[model samples]
Target: MIARVFGASFVVTILSLVVAFLYAGWSGVALCAILGILEISLSFDNAVINATILERMSPMWQKIFLTVGILIAVVGMRLLFPLVIVWATAGLNPVDAMDLALNPPADGAATFADGSASYETLLTDAHPQIAAFGGMFLIMLFLDFVFDDSGVTWLSPIEGPLGRLGRLPGASTVVALAALVTAAQFAADDATVSVLTAGILGLFTYLVVNGLTGLIEQDEPDDSAGPSEAVKAVGKAGLFLFLYLEVLDASFSFDGVIGAFAITSDPILIALGLGFIGAMFVRSITVYMVRAGTLSEYRYLEHGAHWAIGALAVIMLVSVDENIEVPEIVTGLIGVAFIGAATLSSIWANRRDAARQSASPVAD
Candidate 1:
């Protein structure tokens, strides 16, 4: 198992470096390595949550997630998506924007020829949007998990409709329509509007993927080793869990994708570095959860990761329109606290069970 894990990591690392070197020369390799380490460190809980969901999936879906899902995440999200946003909004010619990203601009330039802003400026400018999305996303997540009530909750106004709509086929269509309207509204000149569009894109992307994947696997059996009744219950739970994990992964990747602008805007490099390393870690952690059965054993770990995701989502959303901020370090610390507490609880539960068993008479 360790060998398999090591092999997967090594392959992903090599892919990241190859893409990095091809785009940035020798320096790119170093950049890729650094990004890989950073991503791996930041995404441990993401993997745990993913694994919990994956364990409840059929092997076919698992394979699709590892293969096709990774491609969409790495290439679609980290690389191509950003470039398309810049081209559409900034009015910069695609090739020029590509060149500017590959080679760093002169010491100080606010806007590229296409009128697209610098990565730093653009990302900094977009923070509010990121924050807003994060905030809304987290609020919804938390309220869904904690409240357990249909109405009178903290986010009753939005959550009530969203939860109901989210259960329907039309949610993705509504989001897409919203995105089109958002883009058209800023047809003249407004990077802020474009940023808003991007955030919506991320949100809709989650809904679309979750909805589609859920539909595809709706009829499949749950897991390989669990019981039939457990499978039915866990299958539904796993589907919801999978949806949450995917969104959580996207949320975690948001800042990193934006930060990659600072490293080099070469969309290819950005995609490769973030995609290979980030997706690899996500997959590894997902597999680790299934293989280890951590959720069943630890019990509260999923709760911890979800809570962390909820918090990060809130931080990102609230800051979308304002400068409200929370560091990633804080996010990690919060998750660790929850997991540690859960672990202690699990240990206590195990000991109690052991004592109960020992106290019972044996049929010798």
Candidate 2:
């Protein structure tokens, strides 16, 4: 099962490494490898969150996610998205933006023909808006999860009250908007408007996607319905869920894409590393989790992933302050720590349950 799931990712990783080596020798290979690891570390929780959604999708939709959805992730989000950002923010034509990306100055400090900052600089310059949007979206996701009264609770003291409060209408939106406003205050004066606008758009995007998904699912036939009706309902819901997963991925990738520039500004390496290798493995991991029933086996795993997402949202918001710097490693470690702790807790809980069952009286 492991080989079947990860085989494609392995092939892609090899090809990406070879391409990196051919493009810029050993240094390129090293940078590509590092960026790939960085992306995986940052996105492990993403795979968990994705699996929760993917499990509900039909088999056909699942295949599409592994195929067409991957194309969008690798090409659209990883490569073209950054270029488009640079183009739109830098006020350069698409052709020039592509050129600037493909052929960065050797010194890593050269400006554009109009004497604007370098490609990397412009991309980083757009980070405030990016962070605001992605951060708000993730904040909403985390808040909604914690606010949910269903399922097991990992942190009862905190999640319990939040869940009770979440019963109020539009609780998640109110909290997310409050967070958006708070994050905006920390933004530089020039970036404040952009931050607020992006954050609101992000919140709006989540509402639209989530609302449509809920509406579609609500129309699904009950158990007494015919197989055909059930299949149709699943298809409709799956389509919207697939879209939700993609947008969630885009939100997750925002930090990784911007952080990649810190290691190397070469667009090819970034695409090869984060897009091909890193993203492929994340998809494989998502599939593995679904097939293995990891979430079911480890009760608190989902809670851990959501908690990590909350941490990431805060990190992104806090990062809007140029004076404060949070290392990518710090972000990665916090996620890993949460997941690790959850796994341990799950194991302990399983053992305790087993012991209780053994101690219970049985019927003759």
Candidate 3:
């Protein structure tokens, strides 16, 4: 099962390394390897959260995710998206944006000969809006899950009250809006409008996608319905779910893309490392978890992933104040710690349950 799931990722990783080596010799290879590892560390929680959604999708849709979805992730988000951002923010034409990204200004040069901001500068300038949008979306996701009372919870003391509050209609939306407004207040004067607007848009996007998905899935097919009807229902729901997953991935990628500039300004290396290597491994991990029934066995895994997401959301919002900066490693470690703690708790619970079962008298 492991080989079946990870074989393609392994092949991709090797090819990425080879390309990196040819691009910039050993230094390129090293940088590519580091960025790949960084992406995996930062996105392990993403894999867990993805599995929760992907497991609900049909087999055909699942295949599409590995095929079409991956192209969007690697090419659309990692490569083209950054160029688009630079173009939009810096008033550069498409060709100019691509050229600037391909050949960044020398070290310590913030702008080009014509005085326009460099690709990295423009991308950094756009971070506040990016963070605000992605942060709000992720916080909404985390809040909805924590508020949900239906699932096994790892943090009962905290989640219990949140779940109770969730019974109120639109509780998550109210809280998310409140958060966006509060964060906007702390943003730089110039960035205040952008932050609020982006955050609201993020909140709106979540509502539209999640609402449509819920409305479509609320009516389960009756026993009298033919198999074709069931298939159609699954197909519709799967499409929306696939969309939700893609947006979720985009939110997760925002930080990684920004952080990659810090390590290396080369767009090609960033694509090879984060897009090709990191994303491939993450998708494989997601598939493995679903196929192995890991979520059901561990029980608390989803809870841990959500908690990590909450931490990430808070960190992103906090970092919107240009004066403050949170290291990417700190964010990655916090996620790993939460997931590790949850795994330990799950193992303990399983052992206790086994003991109780063994102690009971045999029904026979």
User: Residue 106, candidate 1: how far off, in angstroms?
Assistant: 2.3
lDDT of 1 at 111: 71
Candidate 1 is scored at a TM of: 0.71
Misplaced by over 4 Å in model 2 are: 110-115, 221-233
Minimal lDDT window, size 10, model 1: 146-155
lDDT of 3 by residue, 215-269 (tens): 7766643235565445433557778888999999999999999999998878889
How close is every model to the real structure, measured as TM-score?
A: 0.71, 0.95, 0.95
lDDT of 1 at 311: 58
Q: Tell me which residue pairs clash in candidate 2.
A: none
| lDDT-better candidate, 1 vs 3 | 3
Candidate 3 residue 266 Cα shift, in angstroms, is 1.0
Per residue, candidate 1 scores C-alpha lDDT tens digits across 81-200 of 565545654565667656656555566576766775675565456555554454444444444444333442223464466556566545534544453344334333444575466556
Query: How many clashes show up per model?
Result: 14, 0, 0
